[model samples]
Target: MTLKSFSGVALAALAVTFLSAASAQANDISKCVLSGEKGSVAITPVNEGAITVETALPNPAWWNGDTPDQIADGYEYCLAANIAHRAGFDKVNLVVSSFPALIANANQNKDLAMATISITDERKKVLSFSAPYFSSDIGVMVKAGTKVDAETVKTFRIGVLQGTTGAKFVSERIKPAEEKVYAENPAMFAALMAGQIDAAITDTAIILGQAAKSNGALTVAAQYQTGEFYGAIYPKESPNKEAMDKIIDDMRADGTLAKLASTYLADSWGADPTKVPYLKP
Candidate 1:
């Protein structure tokens, strides 16, 4: 064959070899797959591996680009994808479910679960967690025209995720007229937008992204420093915990995690972590 033709053929062959290897890896992941709860859906993974990691939404499915049976593009999702890719996992599965559901089925047929889930003493009993990849203060969302000074938030109808740090903060500190628990990020934000709730408390990134996306319809009324960090969840006694923890440690040492944070979150996403303005009623 001609030299140029030979080169082209070689490149094509290399591409085919890569595809074949990738296909083989996917089959490997499927071979080891465990059956998940009824709601979970298989995803076309960025990498192929022996175990399937499951995920709910990024809370804000809008920000994360998560849909049923599709891999999400949110920062948390990206973080999981990166870690799995780094750890030599060839495939991952995505599901859009509430945290309650995700937590309920943690190890049924899934290897890992993520959705900006915070590491907590309570959660440790049921699920193992990798080292922290992200830390943030909680933020409260409110309408653009509302007054949120130190005291005005009490007049605002407030809500938080059912079992989150934000919920703890609201229950113990805010003690609203009637504390509302939302199922997911979008629902909380929707309540705020529709005037159903005057405010919703969530992670800093959610506040930041919502405020930016709302076009002056929503604003971050307040931020509370909860000293919280996000971690990916694994089944209790997960075999991958040690390797995943080491991978996170190495990523931190190499600045991979910070780079990811900046790429996904603004540079100053959580600049302050000590603002406590909630008042117990």
Candidate 2:
């Protein structure tokens, strides 16, 4: 072949190769995203190259409810899936585990934990956290007919999930007259209904969900803007921290995060957290 023709052909081949690689990367991220409702996992191998993502599914409304027998579903779970996909994971193994174990695994550099983990000064010592993706300003849930407010919060019997920011808020800020600790939301909320406690303090999402499901039997009374944002847990120096934070930041910049939260989590949150009414700490 003529030298000029050979050079042109070679350049065309290289161009094709580069385009192919870029296309594959784009394809990877697109297919890696959540299998939104009306989309079928059986048809689209969105998770073909899935990476393990651990989370403690607190409830259907709080976390994704996907089981081995079902598809990935939930607010935080979908949020994690979106961020993971953007970070270049095709799919998430979406393992259900405990919060403590999830944190331990992150400490061990095992898997990415995307549960609704509140960032705190103490946890920052051992774990790297992505930029805040959710807020955990303390919120209150009172039985539907039980009226209360920030000023009188101290007099009511309060239930809070142990070891949570809500528990801390009550213990340190409000110092309720009577307080009870439960292991999880169900237990804490059950106490409220059983009259074991007159109210519950927790993150807005949990309290909103519980109140909604209570069918007017419970309602949110107060929201405290604690400046606590949810951060995904990572190993102390894992590289994923920066990448995950970038993706979350981009989502926020592009209004993607707001849209996701509104669609999947607003019911549980009751309002846009960024603009919602909150109690002064």
Candidate 3:
């Protein structure tokens, strides 16, 4: 080949190499399996395992022949579907891990956390939080006839999701007679249903979701005034923080967030649509 032709080919190869390196750098999030639409954020599952909001079956089917796929059509499942849609993503992978691990993994991998992570001053020190996706108060879940009231349940054995605001609130505000820390909300709720604990403490929204699925097998004793809100978590130094924040702000301003909460969380948790918490710059 002539020298001119060879030089042109070499330049094309160099450009290709540079583009590939930039793309790899852009997608460097460890363990983040990017699928579905653009800007999709992943959530860690509750406890059982990964359940896709887009295609998973409902959990509370009344029919004996109902498969897991059939039950995925419940409101809670649709709520997750709504969250993904409002967040501008068609899908979000759920990673099942403890709250601490979720935070740690998000930080270490430089991936955004779509877990049902509550925003608190303590967590703010280590991570940036998107707008309040769901508002929930701490509450106690107990059997149908359990002798527990909001005020009196402080002395009962309470199960809490480990490393969550619910756990922190129980430890600081309401000292339970005994504390059982589970890695995820579902496990804590399961423990309550199984009669292994007197009560389970968690976000009202989550407990309500479980109660809805269990067909009134559980009841909320009382909602506490923790004033907690769940948000999408990101590394403290994430460049996408500004973009994520802007998306949340837009959602809040445009009534998208309220609509999502009302559809998924309002009936069960009484989440106020007007009570979105503002994030700091």
Model 3: worst 10 consecutive residues (lDDT sum): 56-65
Cα lDDT of model 2 by residue, 1-281, tens digit: 33334222221122222112322223233222232221112121223445456676566564644352354555566666666555445555666666556656533433467767788897777777777765566678887766676677889898987667778788898888898988767788888889999888887766776676677888787788766677777655564556566666665544445544555566554544434356665
Instruction: Give lDDT tens digits, candidate 1, residues 31-104.
Output: 22111121122322323553455665654422355564454444565555555555555455664567778767
Best by lDDT: 2
- Per-structure clash totals for the candidates: 6, 3, 7
Clash pairs, candidate 1, are 47-90, 47-91, 48-90, 48-91, 49-90, 49-91
Error of 3 at 202 (Å): 0.5
Overall local distance difference test of candidate 3: 0.51
For model 2, the stretches where C-alpha displacement exceeds 4 angstroms are 1-48, 66-71, 100-110, 268-277
TM-score of each: 0.73, 0.75, 0.62
lDDT ranking, best first: 2, 1, 3
RMSD of 1: 13.2
Native-to-model Cα distance after best TM-score fit, residue 233 in candidate 1, in Å:
1.1
lDDT (Cα, tens digit) per residue for candidate 3, span 1-281 = 33334322221122222212323222212222121233444333322222232111122211111343233323333334334443444443433344566766443443355545677888788677766655446666788877665456766888987777888888887876789998765677778878788888776655655665667678765667555566666655655566556655554444434433443344543433223222111
